[model samples]
Target: MAEIDPDAKRRPASVKELKAMSHPLRVRIIRLCGDHELTNKQLADRLGVDPGTVYYHVRQLVDAGFLEPAEVRTGESGALEKPYRSTGRSWWLSVQLEDLDTSQGFAPVEAFQQELAEAGPASIASYARFALHLSPEDVAELDRRIVAVIDEYVETDTERAHLPAHGGIFLLHRTPD
Candidate 1:
């Protein structure tokens, strides 16, 4: 499940790409594509939308350069289908509340903060699925393992074709190293 681009490079998203991803469905679509390249039909099946709807969203993402063509496969019926991937591992949308204050004032800021707080919990939970009871020594060992593993991922400048089933680990732990 590890999402490996094999060719990942730190390419920042342009302003246009960021704007296109601002939509909630489009954002989710990007995340899903990050995990694996998929066709519009596959995405629609997974998202429970009609294939046409998924195709439209996918095209918009493609136009913004966030989505790249990955593969072309021939269907059993002889039609060629295209698979698409997200070019970057993640995206950030930066909104300067300070800048907005001069124009829109504080309500927009508060609303933005509230939405982030509400959305964060589920995103966190979806990503975290393990709990361990450990002694101090065990905790230290875990930390070592995590750091070593993370280092392994980052040590190489370029990623590979397939990541491990571990889904490209993002280890977060606070302990004395």
Candidate 2:
């Protein structure tokens, strides 16, 4: 059974928490564990890393409250194993990077590049990019619309067993003239 923490708090990530989650491997860990709880050994095998490395990052995520222990079970060796599940904080994270040093923001960009490099062009479902000049209000409105579409699609989808997992990156920034 999935463990539910009645006191699980959902709030914007603090700088400390963000830093904890800033590493690309950590982000991948969270994504891998999104649907199901996994042991460190399982995560390590999937991520192609050592279990010790995965365990280190998992501890950071659990400490940051972005993951929680789901259940304990027997492994192939008949030893106890603890699995963890995502807290869903990444889905609703609100980060204000204005006053903070934003070096950590590049983690996602790097992850995106790595995924594309691995998947190559053959696995791509869709790709599109647009360059637009607009006022601040127009930019805000566009952002809202984009987010709405993403949220609607994410929320409405219930049958994922037959669907392929998709990765998307939505980037909006003012270009230097």
Candidate 3:
């Protein structure tokens, strides 16, 4: 949840994709896609939302190219459901850091970035709940290194899956920052 590295040569998320993710349900979909490819039912159940709503968001993410159809599975109704995988663990907005007014382009990307920064505590707390076995010092160093990687690999190329998905390691040093 640290500030994204501005000079990391990261590719920025497009306005359309950022807008698609601004929706709360769609954000959950992206998180769900972090692991295994999931059908709408699984996502809806996990998110505590209606299947119809989940279906709509999944379609939107797919259309925006944030989610990809990894497989197809049939339900009890014999309806074919498309299981989706998240294209990336996270996204970085590329709007100018000093741009106060976003009247033209990438406003949604900027907005999402601001929203995430404001919710930093929640991110930190949630990240803390994950299980990781290691000594204190080693864990701290691991956190620093993983964050550097995630922060550095901010470039997101929708044209190709250059970054590995479903693989992330977070470490918290517990030292004052």
Identify the leading candidate in terms of lDDT.
2
Q: lDDT tens string, model 1, 7-58?
A: 2333454556555655655665776787788889888887778999888888
List per-prediction Cα lDDT, in the order shown.
0.61, 0.77, 0.62
State each candidate's clash count. 3, 0, 2
Q: How close is candidate 3 to the true structure, as a TM-score?
A: 0.51
Could you tell me the TM-score of candidate 2? 0.83
Query: Which segments of candidate 1 are over 4 A away from where they belong?
Result: 1-14, 76-78, 89-177
Query: In candidate 1, where is summed lDDT lowest over 10 consecutive residues?
Result: 92-101
TM per candidate comes to: 0.48, 0.83, 0.51
lDDT of 3 by residue, 13-59 (tens): 66676667666567657766855689988888876779999899889
Residues 35-81 of candidate 2: C-alpha lDDT, one tens digit per residue: 67899989988878899999999999999878899889988999999
TM-score for model 1? 0.48
Winner on lDDT between 1 and 2 is: 2
lDDT of 1 at 93: 32
